[model samples]
Target: MPHTRRDHAVVLGASMAGLLAARVLSESFGRVTVVERDALPVDVLATGSRHRRGVPQSRHVHVLLARGASILEDLFPGFVAEAEVAGARTTDALGQVRLLLSGQRLLQTDIGLRSLLCGRPLLENLVRARVRALDGVRFLERHDIVGLTATPDGRRVTGVRIHADGGEQETALDADLVLDATGRASRAPVWLHDLGHGRPTVDTVQVGLAYATRTYRLPQGAMGKDQLILNNATPENQRAAVLAEQENGLARLTLAGMLGDRPPLDPKAFDAFAASLHFPDIFEAIRDAEPLDDPVGFQYPANVRHRYERMRSFPDGFLVLGDAVSAFNPVYGQGMTSAAMQAEAMRAVLADDRDARNGKPLTWRRYFQAIAKAVNPPWQISAGGDLAFPDVRGRRTPAVRMINAYLPKVHAAAAHDVDMSVAFIRVGSLMDRPESLLRPDIIFRVLRGPGRRHPRG
Candidate 1:
């Protein structure tokens, strides 16, 4: 149990980040309230897994990296078991998943890591149910957030102003701390400006990414032993696709293109895009599968990062986490894992603050600094990947150029070297730091150059 340090904490947004934040806040606050604009599903079990309008990308494929899954299990015991019982699929991270990066297929090897595959809605609903069961946590559904309420000095946030979704009456909810987990569409910058504070420094990488997704029910033997197949886009070929087995015995096929090359939603055109991927497995499996839904499209313009730690002045009682702080390119599947890492950092910082038992309020400075550290690695990875394409607009330093050049060789070597494959998988799964990939031993293997190709079974 954590030491109680505050009376109330309010969290904006009830998505993954908000739910995770509220779960941690409940340990130290007497009351935790989550404000969300959407009316979430009442009975997740009865509803099964369905998409909600609040999350536009819910129809797309979502991957819970090994690190994120570990954190979720720690936060909510039996989470993996519960999810599996609910039809979620799990596979040996590197063994049962096919990964084609830079047009090179990685040799399959069991690295003892677990990959959890399910729709975004199912993952969120599982976590939301756990958060709802906490002693001091409550949710305010169908509420529209208006703005922040701060002290007259503008040095501290006192609460938040919100109104019912369909009603005009505004209400102020007071709290000792306010956390923004509203994700990519967060309005924190404008709210901060309204409080007489300067907005945080912004970093943007314009990739102009787009996605088209559809659901299918494939034959039992279609995929054989493989659970997920990911064909990443390379500079030479700016198209990617993923086919993952999801809950309810269904599969999702999402096609992605970068730099204004949008995947078509038309059925024939969608299949053509899938067929154009680096591998033919996705197209082959879905070509004869039962179509469950028409293709849905979503667009992401740029990777945005708000450097709050660099800001000279910030309110004392407010903090931002998750996509509100940094929205990464989703192609790398780092968003949810990064959010989990941030939530863990917040937990550690709050524990230290509680242990000090100081008379002063919680230090927003220390929290934001910790968050920056957590966001740095993933940001570098996703940003570096986006910048790999010459058409993408970003400043590529010498280091980025060197790493991008070396990564292809590494991918090529992994085709025959199991050690190289494991190392790359570990880093990609957020289980290890990116620096591990540059170690002397891994570099030796990578520099060995391309080896004989291992044909896929």
Candidate 2:
């Protein structure tokens, strides 16, 4: 380990994952500093003072999966209560949502993953405000973490040095442990290589996906009742998706497509994009509503994972989490959930290290592998689903190929079969493992039930 358990710990990012990691580190480390290259939003909520930098997909719709939401609430009690009090709408399982695929309504399942909705900034603001109140955790906004400083033996990481206002001074604020909570722009791999440790292995699943989102006022009587409507495109058609509804009565809508199918950046084209969905209700309802912001777009080329867990060796007292390690496309909306699990897994590791020397415990390498176990399932559920498309080229496993082959039927049956819908939605929401979708009953229903030609809106 680097510093004693009482030394300072530094976090490398301040986004949702970074914030969660900082919150947890405060319990063990004496002082925790989070460094971010992008200037954080002063108001973080409505103002979005920090625009379009590191998280370009912030403009796109962000959904906090049910399991992820539960994890966040566990880490910070009364968080869901806080979000509800603030104006975010907590939606019920596939019940409140009107899912349409291939022009028909996905039936309401008895059990579905429940989640909360709001602009990313709004959610971030609530969490950030809570984190800011912590006594030991601190923030260093607009600063860059150049690299990690290690002990003379080069066997452990002691702290981090940041580049600041026209001066370069290495501050040795040692850490009991260091967590790299930085987002996708993380440089942990490069830093590790510089210290003689090899870079983490890499894994990637790519799809030429894009997003275009705009905000609007929910029409009278239409604010809280409407469900998310998605017109998913299978391999047969390259185009896909539309999500429109409430987040604090302030309606937000997005149009997305895969491969070469791109949504328009203009208001007129945006309307056409919505109307083109399997359902016309959502598009018809908002096509004429006032546009609050200019149409914005973000292109996501691939889903990449840094196989840090598979690495041969890692320095003591150093660890990485969240997008810094495995980043998924925002489309699947697994970011926060995966980070929550990472933080939880780390907490368990820290709790188990009884005989830990000074700062960090000795089981640093073990903890990283444990995190991989927690991350892999969700990664498979997400990127695997994305690459199932015709335009998404990859060498897929037989099971992946099987699941991908039958998903359309599962989706089609879900719209008409109650039991199947419940099973599918629960798995999709991360409330359960993907294998749950393979239950005998679900498979029987998907194959034997009346399959709808289209989903209901």
Candidate 3:
């Protein structure tokens, strides 16, 4: 067990990242306060699945990657079982999800990997409820963060100023440590600038991706056999679609387009768009299905990464986690998992800080370095995959070029090879690194590709 540090810590945002941060902080701090602008639902389990105002993309389909589920379970014991009891559907990763990678369907196999499919709001509610139940954790919802409070030298952060919902005056809350987990809209950079510190440089990959989604009610056992169907957008076809089976005989379908190609909101147009994709399974399944809601759309211009690790200096008692540090392409489904991994990294660094006494703090540079390592695999996979599309602009080195070239072949081989498919799923689910997919044996199989077939329209 690690030694306890600080009397109090404040986590900005009640999102997944913030909740995870608060969970970890509870272990080391006497008191941990989570401040959020949005009001949490009173009875999330009874309320069922619904989108939160703060998370615009929650209306779409979301699947918790295997690695992410493990991390969440580590933070909250029996998380998967509890979430399953709350309406999450569990299935073997490859056995249930019909994955089309680079336009080729992976062969069905029992990869032994598992995934929990459900609505984003339900998952967040579960995690939030667990975090709120912790001994040292408390929530201050319906409050807006004004800015970070800092010392005269601007070298260390002391606390934050917040405006409560419908309140005239802002309140000050002090803490020994502060974590910024406000996600993509985070104003941490602006707050740092206000404190006379330079904001971290940002790296971006512009894909101009847009997607639309809607929920549908299906007859019991109508989905039959396959719980999920996905066709990832490839260079040959820069459009993708995914249909995931949720609890209560409902399914969520998401259609993605690239380089200014947006999915329409009309139901007929949405069905037509799904049909237009390389895969027909999604359209076939949902064409005659009952539409529960109108199609909703979301746009992502680019995947952004704040290079905090590259910055030479950082204020004490201040750190950024989750989308505030790096926001990945949503198509990859790495956000929550990546945030959980970052929290794990923070836990490790905090645990190692024996010299955190005498007013000294854990070094942000070292922590950011650890985070950069954790973010690299997913970033390379998602951003590199996006860069495969000719219209997306980014620097591609020889290794990236080589990987992109071999990826199509890999997908082709996975169509017929169960072992190859398992390797691909493992890497995609963040359970293993990209290197696992590039082993000599897998490379040979990809190169040989005995059962390879032509592309399907």
Candidate 4:
């Protein structure tokens, strides 16, 4: 067992990132407190699956990448089994889910990857429950974060100030460390500026992404044996759709478009958008399905990355993780998984703090550096994909250009090559680095192009 290095640690936000941070912090801190502005579900097992205001994308389909599931299992043992017990669907990643990239259908095969299909609420609740069960961990739900509380010299963060929802006065909570896990709209940069520290460099890729999502109850044998269908958009189409099987016999279909093209909320127009996807699988499955809810829309302006590691100076006992550091295009389904990976990075950094025995606080600089390494690959993958569209605004460096040009060929070859398909999926799931896709053997297959048809299960 590791010795407790800090008396208390405070985590901002109660989302996946915040919950994961609290879980990891409990090991090194004597007490961990998570503060959130929204009211959390009291009985996660009973009403946890219902959507909340904070997570606007709750209505959309969410997939737990294989790499992320493995990390969660490591952090909280039997996480996969527990999620299954909570009505989440587990299926062979390649064999059961249809993947279409750049208008090419990847051949089905048992790639040894697992896909966990469940509503975002259910997944967050499960994680929140695990964090809540930890000793000396507590939640301060329905509270608004006021600001950071620093030492006299402003060299270290002492804690945070927060106001209870509907309360008149703000309360100060003292801690040895403060971690900001607030999502895309994080105010950490502004806070740092106020504290007389230079803001981190910001990188933005304007994707102008929009989504329209709806729920339905499909008829018996609607998709035959398939559990999920993802038809990604290409520059030629500029539209995408995903129909995923969720718990409670529900199917959630989310239609997406890029570059100011928005999917409609009108029932007929929504179907028309799905029908116009590269493939008709999603449209065909939901054509006669029973409507469960009205379509909802979400717009994402850009993918933003705060280059905190490049900042010359940062206060001690203060750190940022998750979407607060980088927000990616949702079409890639990398947000939650990226947060999980960042949490794992935080865990590793905390565990490696040899100075903890001397009562030294965590090295925030090291933590940020570790998470930057963790976020780089996924950010590049998603950003590179967005840049493939002629309309997206960003610097298309030679490296990005080369990779973008090669991806189409890779996708084409993966249509019939099982090894090629598995390799692509592994990289997409973050199981392996993107460089693995450039191996000599994989390159050879790409050069040869797709082969004759193969039987698909």
- For residue 391, model 2's alpha carbon misses the true position, in angstroms, by 2.4
Better of 1 and 2 by lDDT: 1
- Evaluated at residue 142, the lDDT of candidate 2 is 73
Please give the range of 10 consecutive residues that has the lowest summed lDDT in model 4. Answer: 354-363
TM-score of 2: 0.90
- What tens-digit string does per-residue lDDT give for candidate 3 at 1-457? 1123488899999989999999998988899999999988857677668667888888888888888899998999999999888889987888888887787778876666778899898889889888978998999999999999888998888899999999999989998888999999999888888788888899889999898999998666655677888889987778898889887768999999999999999888888899998877788888788998999999999999998898876788888999999998888888888998899988888877744554455587888988898888888888887778878987788888888888888888888777788888899889999988788988988888665442211
Angstrom error of the Cα, residue 115, model 1: value is 1.5
lDDT for each candidate structure: 0.88, 0.75, 0.85, 0.88
RMSD, one per candidate, in order: 2.2, 3.2, 3.0, 2.1
For model 1, residues 67-170, the per-residue Cα lDDT tens digits are: 89989999999999999997888878888888988988889867778879998888898889989999999999999888999889888888999999889699
Clashing pairs in 4: none
lDDT of 3 at 426: 92
Comparing 3 and 4 on lDDT, the stronger one: 4
Better-scoring candidate (lDDT), 1 or 3: 1
